[model samples]
Target: MQFICLIYNAEDNGPQPGTDEFGPYMQAYADYTQEVQDAGVMVGGEALQPIATATTVSVRDGKTELMDGPFAETKEQLGGYYILDCKDLDEALKYAAKIPDAKYGRVEVRPVMVFD
Candidate 1:
């Protein structure tokens, strides 16, 4: 089974701290990535640009509507994601908990739906 771990955090919190604070965060992630990679669980992952750079689109009445920013406004914004191959939801949850954001924000672990 595969799952996507969606990382979310507050945009108002501003850019993550510089080298001082960021160093620990990066080290934590590096450790987690290495552990998962060693276990053959990590498939892929990436960090996303800020929400301010996002564009939203919707279609209604046969017309396409384009709007600036994310689909919704919230204190927490989707910041990145990790796609993992896991034995099950429980295993995925364990991995999600290791994400640094899980301490201050949220890491939503959702299974991927595959179409036959």
Candidate 2:
């Protein structure tokens, strides 16, 4: 089975990039990345740009509309994701819990849907 762990966090809380404050988090995530890769569960993962850089689009009444930010505003924003191959949801959740962001943020584990 395949699972995606969607990471969410408050932009106000985390360390900013390219600063000393970000070092520890970088090391933590790097260690986590290595562990998952070594365990063969990490299929892929990436960190997303901040929500300020996002663009939202919607279509209504045959017209296209554009928004400058995300689809909706919230205290927590979708920060990144990890795709993992696992035996089942239990395994996936276990992996999700290991993500560094899980300490201060949320890791939403969802099984991938297959079409056949």
Candidate 3:
């Protein structure tokens, strides 16, 4: 089964670049990525640009509408994601718990849908 682990955290809440904590924080991610890759469960993953760079779009009445940033604000923002191939939800959850952000942030794990 394939699962997507949605990572969420406050944009300014964690270690910032140029800070001592930043290096270890990023290294944690690298370590996690390597672990998953070595385990053969890493399908894909990436960290996203800040929410400030996000653009929301919609189409209504044959017209396109664009809005700056996300459509709504929240305490935590979607920061990144990991797609993993696992035996089942149990295994997926196990991996999700290991995600670095899960310590201070959130990781939502959901199974991928397949269409005929």
Q: Which candidate wins on TM-score?
A: 3
For model 2, residues 1-116, the per-residue Cα lDDT tens digits are 88999999998777768888799988989998898899998999999998999999999999999999888799899999999999989989988998888988899999888687
Identify the runs in model 3 with alpha carbons over 4 angstroms from their true place.
none
Worst 10 residues of 3 by lDDT: 9-18
lDDT score of residue 55 within candidate 1 = 97
lDDT by residue for model 3 (74-111), tens: 98999999999999999999999999899888999999
lDDT of 2 at 32: 88
Residues 1-116 of candidate 1: C-alpha lDDT, one tens digit per residue: 98999999895553276647778887888988899899999999988998889999999999999999999788899999999999999999998999888888899999999788
lDDT rank order: 3, 2, 1
Of models 1 and 3, which has the larger TM-score?
3
Instruction: Evaluate residue 70 in candidate 3 and report its C-alpha lDDT on the 0 to 100 scale.
Output: 80
| Model 2 poorest 10 in a row by lDDT | 12-21
lDDT of each: 0.88, 0.90, 0.94
